[model samples]
Target: MDFLTSSTHLHITAWVVALVLFLVGAFVSKSKGIHMALRLFYILTIITGGALFIEAMDYGMGMQYGIKFLLGILVIGMMEMILVRQKKNKPTTMFWILFAVFLFAVLYMGFKLPMGQNFLA
Candidate 1:
């Protein structure tokens, strides 16, 4: 139980795995297996993230957590949007750009915000 909540362990782990999965999907564009794995990672991310958000709320950091949570979901959405566009053989330049921007923002906020990892600390 302690491990689950400690230092946002679960949430971080899920995101790391999801990142790897995302990369796999990107590299293996036509692989349904990679796509399925990426989808699973998305679910894992959401579950772990929800747990962390609830914990944050208990510590009176709900607003900060909420923003991060939404950004995280947006990141996932961007990934799916890219995949969808690719599947349809449509241009994905815009979605790719948005994904990169959102990914940077989410990572920056997660490590910089006081309510988050505050990696500098």
Candidate 2:
């Protein structure tokens, strides 16, 4: 469906789902089911995000797009690090804090950047 490939729809939908899953994992107990679900959401977010980046390339935004792509990967990495630390019974506070910071950064960039057809557009 055209809607599925549309950058706006895909990015927003994936991020919203990922954010909800992140909240659940952070605030509530992390169960195996939740972990798998979160992984699925992460994959979906990356795929959709990559698609958005490719589409945005046509607009010739240059390094901004690349930076967001890398930051997005870091955000995902931070999330995985948080979960891994938790599973290892290690100190997750630092990872959790970093995750939050990176998440905020990604969100700020996503909203501020003139990339896709956002809701305000």
Candidate 3:
């Protein structure tokens, strides 16, 4: 119970939930319900990410935090482009590639990288 209230725990929980939602959304692309769920999931992701950014800034992990924030924004932008642009094969392929790179970067920052070490430590 106490762990649930800890900042590090909360951050991890948020990221895990976001990642799961992203995977589910991607896999269930044929369903409108899943698409809507993805939108809501993304909203939660943004909110939690913003909170983590603020915490990082306050504690002096600014560089890592900034990088993560930029990556998140880029991912969201690419997704928006994919959704709004005409359904053409070339554009769709390009968008998916960009999104894949963005996802990789986000995972690196969120997991493999030491971005949140200061807070977690």
The top-ranked prediction according to TM-score is 1
**Ten-residue region with minimum lDDT total, candidate 1:** 1-10
Query: Candidate 3, clashing residue pairs?
Result: none
lDDT digits (tens) for residues 1-121 of candidate 1: 5555666767788889888877777766579888898899899889877877777777677787788889999999999888877888899999899999889988987887654666766
Can you give the TM-score per candidate against the true fold?
0.87, 0.85, 0.67
Predicted model with the maximum lDDT? 1
Q: Write the per-residue lDDT of candidate 3 for residues 1-121, one digit (tens) a residue.
A: 3333245556566556656655565544545575566566567667767777766665567888788888987887676556545323234668779988997887677664454445334
TM-score-best of 1 and 2: 1
**Count of backbone collisions in candidate 3:** 0
Give the clashing residue pairs of candidate 2, or none: none
lDDT of each: 0.82, 0.77, 0.64
The better-scoring model by lDDT among 1 and 3 is 1
| Candidate 1 stretches greater than 4 Å from native | 1-3
- Collision pairs in model 1: none
